[model samples]
Target: MASSPNIFGKAQADVLAETGTALLQIKNSRRLTLEDMARVLGRTDDMVAKYIAGEAEMGFVAFRRASEAWPELTEKLNGGAE
Candidate 1:
């Protein structure tokens, strides 16, 4: 029988943490304030802060948009995964 892939594991947690950190780094490198990231992501500053703080995981759609918009940073965060 076919088996489902494990979606919740250390690897997933690592990916989330890495992605969150990379997002924050990108913002810093670009000299973008939290408000700037919020504007780019169409989210509130509080939400962007939460994302940067790793208090909230971005939904797949938002992640996709971010990945598309910032491929370099996303690639680093996602371990080069598309």
Candidate 2:
């Protein structure tokens, strides 16, 4: 059977939703700010804000830096307790 385009789009949206929520939660739990997250990703505050808002998708390098800086973020992104 051929997959519909909506299926792929929904999957991507789900990933973005999960990632954005995780980023927000982790930032709050660690008492971090947008500047802090941006520093980790080597991005601007607005860029990190976009990531947390689910307005932008974070690339692999950003994920790597975020995970390195916060092990909790890694677990959250991996769906917990990996």
Candidate 3:
């Protein structure tokens, strides 16, 4: 049997893309590598990359850590982060 379709579909993809962009911007602003972001979130570098690539969902704890890591970017992103 096939897996059920994602309920949100396109909307979900849009959110992921926006999230990836925001994270990328924040990382660039901090001059941080994927490893740095992983360290900040207590995750692995590949996990950070997956989140950035829109292949993983960002957990609240990770979001909080990122916000703490770069408050300015987080605020900017909240204001239509694209």
Error of 2 at 44 (Å): 0.6
Q: What lDDT does model 3 reach?
A: 0.78
Per-model lDDT: 0.73, 0.83, 0.78
Q: Put down candidate 2 lDDT per residue, 1-82, tens digits, no spaces.
A: 9652443446766777778899999888889999988998999999999888888888889888988888888688767952
TM-score leader: 2
What's the lDDT of the predicted structure labeled candidate 2? Answer: 0.83
Error of 1 at 26 (Å): 0.4
Candidate 2, run of 10 with poorest lDDT: 2-11
Residue 60 C-alpha lDDT in model 2: 89
What lDDT does candidate 1 reach at residue 15?
A: 57
Q: In each prediction, how many residue pairs overlap at the backbone (N, C-alpha, C within less than 3 A)? A: 0, 0, 0
Candidate 1 residue lDDT tens string, 14-44:
5566767888888877788888877778788
After best superposition, candidate 1 residue 57: deviation in angstroms? Answer: 1.1
Off by over 4 Å in 2: 1-10
Q: What is the lDDT of residue 55 in candidate 1?
A: 75
Indicate which candidate wins on lDDT.
2
Q: Evaluate residue 6 in candidate 2 and report its C-alpha lDDT on the 0 to 100 scale.
A: 47
Residue-level lDDT of model 3, residues 1-82, one tens digit each, is 9653452454566666667878888888778999988999989999989888978888899889888877764666566543
The TM-score obtained by model 1 is: 0.73
| Lowest summed lDDT window (length 10), candidate 1 | 3-12
